[model samples]
Target: MEKNLAQKYNHKDVEEGRYDEWVKKGYFTAGDKSKDPFTIVIPPPNVTGILHIGHAWDNTLQDIISRYKRMQGYDMLYLPGMDHAGIATQARVDARLKSEGISRYDIGREKFLERAWQWKEEYAATIRKQWAKLGNSLDYSRERFTMDEGFNDAVRHVFVTLYNEGLIYRGWRIINWDPEARTALSNIEVYYQDDPGKMYYFDYKVEETNEYFTVATTRPETMFGDVCVVVNPEDERFSHLVGKHAVNPANGEAIPIIADSYVDVEFGTGAMKCTPAHDPNDFAIAERHGLEKPICMNPDGTMNALSGEYEGMDRYECRDKLVERIKEEGNLIKIEDITHNVAHSERTHCVIEPYLSEQWFVKMKPLAEDVLKNQNDPDQRINFYPERFSRVFEQWLENIEDWCISRQLWWG
Candidate 1:
């Protein structure tokens, strides 16, 4: 054996069959009742695709900890698993079907689900092979899938328990909507980017009087939903305009001029259009003032009946057409080009609409409060590394809103 040493090591020769041997010996399995347990559950990789370098890096760290614990005579159970990845998996399957000139809709629910399961199996096998090649010391005997029977039962049990406890409720609320996906997204799922846009200043004439107050908006399309024009109560310039009604420049509809401190005194002629159904801040103002919230856009981002003649048109298309009409009617004051932040869906990459919809929500504030109390307790405190992260976690928890727990997707 000493006479034939290769200059470069052959990893295949050395590593082949080693992991199988380790598994057969039950080295990575943890069934011992005597030794103290040390477990690390893999943050299940998505079944939508093959694992990448990120997965390798993450697994390597877990593998190191698991091996170290095993060496220290602990009953190590490095559990392995894969996620069904609800939306992500469904998107992948849909894309695949589209390539074959057919859609999931054409195939129907049952057939479409069969394809999704096939995709899961294919990707899960690839991931398992990847983990083996990486020499991860995982307990394959205890492997799990998110959609497995036991996991489904566990999820249902928790959901029902939360519902019974009054922690979960269904109600209408403003949410980030993905038009392309036809689903509601959580706030974190919408990312903002600076986009070159136009600010349109238009005249809102006082009803039954020649007096006019100018208002500016970046989204002229949403003007059809405007319930009121808001000005700061303390602003001397627009104090006289308060309590008067203004004609909506888009359709000559009467909208009240209201005073609210939420309006920025220096921005856009100091007047803000309140579209309660389409804007969160406006919705809050509507709640305080008892103004009606009327939705102007359809779920698919088309103008609805509330948009009048602009109905059935895309929101942006309506904007272009309405702007032209406004200018023709002598209501358009000016247009200024500027860059502003626009929210876009993380998955679909389409512009995210602030949509009002009825959906399931989980009360998160109470849960967050409990977590904060536990974190501050000396006996039960969970330690964080790079300790400054504790403040980041605390800050996020302190401002946590109700979590939207439902999606308009067939999967998950």
Candidate 2:
């Protein structure tokens, strides 16, 4: 009490004391590889992040398992690393420069990327410091970054080998585009929200007839590239116009009425506009009809030349203009605001624009087949937590798309 020099809790005083002791005791070091081996890789965190609650929880669990393995006298390796999250890291650096009143373009790509590497080094140092605090028994001596030369070489080697095997390809495909990032994203990166919006109805004149059929759609602006109108072949309602075409409500472009099983007979009058350039399902229909797939928007979700007067405008703005134009043409139908799940880019957080673009992809059918076969035979299978997630895993494997693997950015 005289000096207030000694505290009741000496944890802080023993901080450096405990860490050095643990490391010196070889608790953090790996045993000889000759011993019965045990290894658990510490999941690499995104380079753009600091430790959060989820990281804290996850690392805590890993630490417990590693400690138990060491006690069991197993040679162990818990290697630590960071994932160079391309878009996320780029966005973080861009944001930092924005605060400093500078732009990446002003600094040039090499310089900007050098700055990003600096940020990564700082964060890596902090991560090492934080992991120390958490007592994670990760082998920092062998730490790796996903973007390091050796890792990059491995990535390139895999890519080249897969491409040579025809398991990789580049082609025109329908993809969910991130406008703000101007990049093609894998389907897994898309997040959905229930959005409240109106579906617009427009009248289409039947070719060689004065009568017109109305279509109800949530995305009216995509009418710019309508190649056809689709309905179920068994749909008795539109059977009369089955062999004919329709005059586009706004552009007067004639598009044939085609029957396809993809349409659900009960949804929105059972009549759907086929805009191959803007919808995935419609792209399939276009291929069937040998329709020319002209793109109406850029990867960044801005209007392109196919949009005519709406060219260069943002997609939502063009949507408004298209609706107004149809209204003026006396072909506009009623609109009702409704809630629905809208998909957005996970990186840019912009509404996902379905666009036709050239991109690199991975053929996944064989990979999925192997996963499914293993999953179906439960005796020799991996696992899922909570039990319910097992069904989700199975479902995902069943419907896995060809993975889009390219990014316009350099750090991927």
Candidate 3:
């Protein structure tokens, strides 16, 4: 009918014609807010995006609700927007530029940012166009981008206020880092996968006394950052060596072997490597002893200057190289293939790097107390569709990590 009817009749194209009319008539534009205002913030599509079926469904639902509310005489503010999706948006443009023989490095961050803003303006129209087709009553005049001045100011304000209120702090904490995107990601952005890898058993010799103690590790690449060797304080297996040192086979660096009550006595060798910069558990141990964190790899998960012999190699490559070195020294006791969960970035899908960074984190405890203890309000008017989503909302907010809102990318 689309092909045959259009040629036979002068009827305007249904999708485009109606969409243009609605935009011009301003049915979708929100008027001034009254004392009573109703708003359903359409979850902003990431700026690094194209609308898919799921997004379309979401917009359709929101539009229906907004229209219903507008008819009910509520000042409707179905705010439209897009996210400055830091890594995601940057990756999209970067890939598009790769075909043109241009890299982000060639144009620089400033120019790349300009191009990204151009992208936002271009796609923002498509969002409105989609909404119009779905017959949604969105206030296009008030459409906001995540990077808009007011919103960015709000993000900054939240950060500064939280900091002043002692609800936010900077500390050397273990964070999930994206290797390919070179950024710290919130826990929500990480997906876990079971990886098949080997656990290497290396004999650590005391520096002063030639007595040896064995430690098993799945990640030999982090050996360069090993500051201490920890054992269960009550474990009888290695109680004699409580105050001794252990020699890292490949690095020959001596690390104090101490007993900690936190150590699980059953987990291999009853001893673990304390790499403050790498393992979350080790960071706690380091904090207990007031030791410095030495990050062995770059933000991209490549060996940094700290990884002496493997400075230019990938972290995984350094693993193999380090294993070989340990094997030659006769410290390699045994190897076992084991399945373990590894976290990967949601955007890049690359294995995440665990790094100690002084990133910002909010104290969720106080926020939780307020939100949990407060009674459900009839006048507050908070709502979500499908009703089930409210449970998801409550559950998410219940155990939310200190939101790390910073990103390394310049473009969005």
Report lDDT (CA) for all predictions: 0.91, 0.84, 0.81
List, residue by residue over 255-283, the lDDT tens digit for candidate 2: 88889899999988799988887788889
For residues 257-299, what per-residue lDDT tens digits would candidate 1 score against the true structure?
9999999999889999999989989999999999998999999
Q: Which residue pairs show collisions in model 3?
A: 86-412
Candidate 1 regions off by >4 Å? 1-3, 17-27, 33-35, 98-102
Give each prediction's root-mean-square deviation over alpha carbons. Answer: 2.3, 3.1, 4.1
Per-candidate TM-scores read 0.92, 0.89, 0.86
Candidate 2 lDDT at 109 equals 86
- Provide the lowest-lDDT 10-residue window in model 2: 1-10
TM-score order of candidates, top first: 1, 2, 3
Answer with 1 or 2, whichever has the higher TM-score: 1
- Model 2 spans with C-alpha error above 4 angstroms: 1-7, 16-37, 68-75, 98-107, 375-379, 383-391
Residue 379, candidate 3: C-alpha displacement in angstroms: 10
